[model samples]
Target chain A: GESVGLHLPTLSVQEGDNSIINCAYSNSASDYFIWYKQESGKGPQFIIDIRSNMDKRQGQRVTVLLNKTVKHLSLQIAATQPGDSAVYFCAEKGANLSNNDMRFGAGTRLTVKP
Target chain B: DAGITQSPRYKITETGRQVTLMCHQTWSHSYMFWYRQDLGHGLRLIYYSAAADITDKGEVSDGYVVSRSKTENFPLTLESATRSQTSVYFCASKWQMNTEAFFGQGTRLTVV
Candidate 1:
């Protein structure tokens, strides 16, 4: 079955260092891809997104890179902060209006050491 | 006060019990979705609605039911809860086809 997956279950980084999380998906028919940040006990928060037509997109301090050929996705955060410590997830949107609105990766726990 | 919200932030129920999780959004978005997050598993889509009265099942919809009587609400019902149903559920909505989804605080359900 086609699904989204993460490269690592957890990641540790220095407070001021950069952080990168990776994900791989199998569906090429997806409409777009999104990265979400989830704090403990809270819902996933939308961080950034990239459309299928584009290979990369950037937000305030975040960036999402998509590699269609390998069906891979990645989220890069510049200057990791203590508040950036959370579970990050990558998801690929499903077709237009079918059941699969988005398929998510298991998630990577990003721990920033202060 | 204009974002998505889920009721009973947390819940505990026994196996075989019927439970319904509520999700409400004030944006009047055209799309709403329900997803469950479990340990070691990616968030799984249970159901989604393109519009009021239009609903469809997702990858994991076997034991779940959903309805959207109004554009602002999409509730998920578990006919008979099982231990495996213990997980965090999130409700989200997007304004259009190509947009970021706003998520609720999420409901942590524990089936004992």
Candidate 2:
């Protein structure tokens, strides 16, 4: 069995502070990982992604870090804002058999306080 | 350009009735996936299709059926809807593995 999980269920931060969301995956064979931001009543939106070959990838205001040796993935949001508040989920894609499938983490709720 | 679209954004069906959720993608992606989102379960994959006429079950596929007659469409049907089948269903499409997937708004199904 494979599992992907987050370090915390919820995170609260100030409007101007930085926020870090951590995810630990159990499958070492997973070669690709993605971070999604989901707002209430909406579908998950693509944020950033990192491959096992790379350690970090940066986007508009978000960065994804991957530590393959430790099977850990993290999403860093710089200067948190009210718009950044959402449930963040990490997903890993792997070749389960002949086909490919993606497994999603439990999700970490990010709440930014004004 | 519409990336992906789903029908019946909100649905309410009976427990024993049959319900089908439609998913369509305009990018002509080869891969399409159906997932249900629950409070504690996160997003669980129910089924996925690699191409037209080719489909496979995912982590949670029981009580559900899927068909990909065309590459642009993937539909998920609940043979007999149950209270447990009530959840927000999402459809996603990716050009290939390790690529970014575009998701539809999602269908909220409530079984009574």
The DockQ leader among the candidates is 2
Indicate which candidate wins on TM-score. Answer: 2
Candidate 1 clashing pairs, residues 3+ apart or interchain: none
Which regions of candidate 1 fall more than 4 Å away from where they truly are? A94-100
CAPRI grade of model 1: medium
Residue-level lDDT of model 2, residues B3-71, one tens digit each, is 899989999999999999999998989999999999988899899898999999888999999999999
Instruction: Report the poorest 10 consecutive residues by lDDT, candidate 1 chain B.
Output: B94-103
- State the DockQ, from 0 to 1, for candidate 1: 0.69
- A17-70: candidate 2 lDDT, tens digit per residue: 999999999888889999999999889999998888999999988889999899
| lDDT (tens digit, per residue) of candidate 1 on B48-83 | 999999999887898999999999999999999999
Give model 2's TM-score versus the native structure.
0.96
Q: Total clashing residue pairs per candidate?
A: 0, 0
For model 2, the superposed segments whose C-alpha errors exceed 4 Å read: A95-99
TM-scores, one per candidate: 0.94, 0.96
**Each prediction's DockQ?**
0.69, 0.78
